[model samples]
Target: MAMIVQARAADAGAIASLAEEIWREHYTLLLGEDQVTYMLDTIQSEDVIRQAIESGTVYWLVKEDGELIGYVAYDLRESELFLSKYYLKHSFRGRGIGRYLFDELKQVAIENRLPAIELTVNRENTRSIEAYRALGFHVLREHVGDIGGGYVMDDYVMQYVIS
Candidate 1:
């Protein structure tokens, strides 16, 4: 069984490590090795993860049998919860871990009275887009933004409305 635990400052290193592994395994083919390296170095560094936690982004680490396998991060904004990151180890995918994480997020939304949960998924991430659709998320729009380093995130903004 997998359990989600609130990440603390001490978990920064583990989170960074897991992010690097998962991003490389899952995104290298789609985003290229260079972009993957850039993102992991810039966004998933230990310091960056720590700073995000300190700056009010809530991170939850998924653990099974005492091993860290995945993590999800989100921020509550006024009436919305923004899911900034959701990743699982390659071996842990397709095992309902993602759904378990989403279910937890929904409970958080209900507790906070948020109207919806929103996130942006890379346009080429067909599996994730389909999973979001299965979970009742709808595409709000498509957006492309340059994230510096000569790379742009071409993504679809998806939202799950609370019913």
Candidate 2:
């Protein structure tokens, strides 16, 4: 059985390693090697992840049969849950794991009395956009933010309203 467990600060290094592997395999084509490397070093490094966790970002690890296969990270905003990161191993795709993780997010929203869950998806990442749509998310708006290194994230801000 796959279970979701809260991640601790000590788990930051493991999450960083998984993020590198996942981004290289899945995002290199869309983001190119240079941007992926830059984002990894800046946003997904172990120190950064540890700081985020220490600052109250909630992280959950997806463990299946004692192996860590994926992670979800989010923060509770005044109005909604801000989903910062959601990634699974390439081989773990198409196994309903994404839906499993999403169900957990929904529960978090309910617990926090948040009205919705929001996340930004790269505009070029059609696969993820479609999956989010299937989960009842809608494109709230477009966003293009410079993440330094002369690269920008051109993404669609999406929201899933909870009932």
Clashes of each: 0, 0
Tell me, by TM-score, which candidate is best.
2
Cα misplacement distance, residue 156 of candidate 2 (Å): 0.3
Candidate 2 residue-wise lDDT at 2: 79
Model 2 lDDT tens row, 1-163: 6799999999999999999999999999999999999999999999999999999999998889989999999999999999999999878888999998999899989998999999999999999999999999999999999999999999999999998
Of candidate 2, the 10-residue stretch with the lowest lDDT total is 86-95
Q: For residue 101, give model 1's deviation from the true position in Å.
A: 1.2
The pairs that clash in candidate 2 are none
RMSD of each: 0.8, 0.7
What is the total number of backbone clashes in candidate 2? 0
- TM-score, predicted candidate 1 vs. hidden true structure: 0.97
